[model samples]
Target chain A: QQPVQSPQAVILREGEDAVINCSSSKALYSVHWYRQKHGEAPVFLMILLKGGEQKGHDKISASFNEKKQQSSLYLTASQLSYSGTYFCIEGGSNYKLTFGKGTLLTVNP
Target chain B: EPEVTQTPSHQVTQMGQEVILRCVPISNHLYFYWYRQILGQKVEFLVSFYNNEISEKSEIFDDQFSVERPDGSNFTLKIRSTKLEDSAMYFCASNLDREPRAFFGQGTRLTVV
Candidate 1:
């Protein structure tokens, strides 16, 4: 099944912060976060392989709650360049990924 | 940095015609996959190939869809009879051995009319 992402869309000003959440109905082996700009392919951000493990890039970080079948992406001190759509893909034994509909983030100056 | 590359960034075709989207996965990767995303929709998995054979495929990937590693450095997805609904961006991905982290290609935008 596809993972569910919350706050389908968000708008933030420079230096602001935002969070995107993803939850699945089944257990999660790993959660992946990706960002895509308008007319561009998705770019891998980070992956959380186990519960309580956090990964980050620049000001973007994410946490995985395996027990809850959830993961969250945190964007801190957002920049205009951070404007894009973010998707979360849940992976497990099947190795098949079902991506979330995505969260549209608009960062304005 | 090694990256997956796809050709003909955009393609336009008519219904019932055949369309081939090509991709060159990152060198040294052992697994290849194909995914599609309709405009304003979530990306969907189509299939995965490893060891020159399909490992898994989604229901959306019926008999009409086929994947091939025709030669070194090239992987392709061919739709035997394209439908208008097939219009979407197709992404090719690959991952190293035992790694679940997939690197996606820029994608080929197929527009079937």
Candidate 2:
């Protein structure tokens, strides 16, 4: 099944902060994060393994909670370039990925 | 700096016709995948290939859709008979191994009429 992402859309000003979360009911082997610009393909951000580790890109960071089957992405001091749609794909033991509906983020200056 | 590359950035074909989207994954990557996104829809995985064979596939990857590693450098997705619903952005991706960080191509914008 696809993971569930919170806050269908978020609006923020430059330098503001926001958090997007994804949760799944199945046992997850990995959680992947990607950002898609308008009318473009999704760009890879980072991946979190089952070991409950976190990865980051500049001010964008993510955490995976192995026990909770949840992951959270944090965007701090956001920039206008950060405005885009964020998607989380959950990979379970089966090695197949189910993606969420996505969270649309708009960061304005 | 290596990234996945796809050809025919945009393709328009009539229904019942066949279409083949090509991709060249990172030179050293062993795992390849095909995914599609219907307009305004979430990206859906079609299939994954490893060891020159399909490792996993989704129900969407029915008989109409097939993937092949035709040669040492090319991976292709062939849609035997195009349908209007097949109009979407088809993306090719590759990974270093079983790792979750997948590098995606610029995508082929398939428009079936």
Candidate 3:
């Protein structure tokens, strides 16, 4: 099943911070975060395994909580390049991914 | 950096016609997948291929849809008889393994008229 993402859309000024959350009903082996710009492919941001580890990329970071079957993505000091749609994909036991509806993040100058 | 490449950035075909979308994943990546996004919709997984066969497939992948690794370097998705609903951006992706990040192609905009 597809996960649920909170805050369907968010607007931020450059250097602002935002958080997007994803929650799933089923247990996830891993959670993958991706950013997609208009008319472009989704780019891999980071992957968080089930061990409750947190991973970061530049000003973006994510935490996965296995017990609650949830993951949160943090964007700090956002940049103009950060404007895009963020998708959280849950990996099942079979390794197939089910993506969320996506959160649209717009970072203004 | 290695990236997955897809062919025919845009394709337009009449309903009921067959269409094939091709992709070349990063070399040495063992796991391949096909996903699609209807205009303005979220990405949906279609199938995953490994070891020269489909490892898992979603309901979206039915009798009319099939995938093949025709050659060592190419992965393809074939729709035997397309429908209007099949019109979407088809993305091909691949990863090194089960837990690694999957890289996606720019996607082929399939317009079924």
Indicate which candidate wins on TM-score: 1
Model 1 stretches astray by more than 4 angstroms: A66-68
What tier of docking accuracy does candidate 3 attain? Answer: medium
Can you write out model 1's per-residue Cα lDDT over B1-113, one digit (the tens) per residue? Answer: 78999988999999999999999999899899999999988899999998999999999999999999999789999998999999999999998888888989999999998
lDDT at B63 for candidate 1? 96
Q: Write the per-residue lDDT of candidate 1 for residues A53-92, one digit (tens) a residue.
A: 8889789999988484989999999999999999998875
Q: Give native contacts recovered, as a fraction, per prediction.
A: 0.68, 0.59, 0.74
Count steric clashes of candidate 2.
0
List, residue by residue over B30-79, the lDDT tens digit for candidate 3: 99999999999999999999999999998989999999999899999999
lDDT of 2 by residue, B2-78 (tens): 88999989999999999999999999998888999998889998999889999999999999999889888999999
Specify the highest-lDDT model's number. Answer: 3
Output the worst ten-in-a-row residue range by lDDT, candidate 1 chain B: B94-103
Interface RMSD of 3: 1.2
In model 2, which runs have C-alpha deviations exceeding 4 angstroms?
Answer: A92-96
Q: Report how far residue B13 has shifted in candidate 1, in Å.
A: 1.1
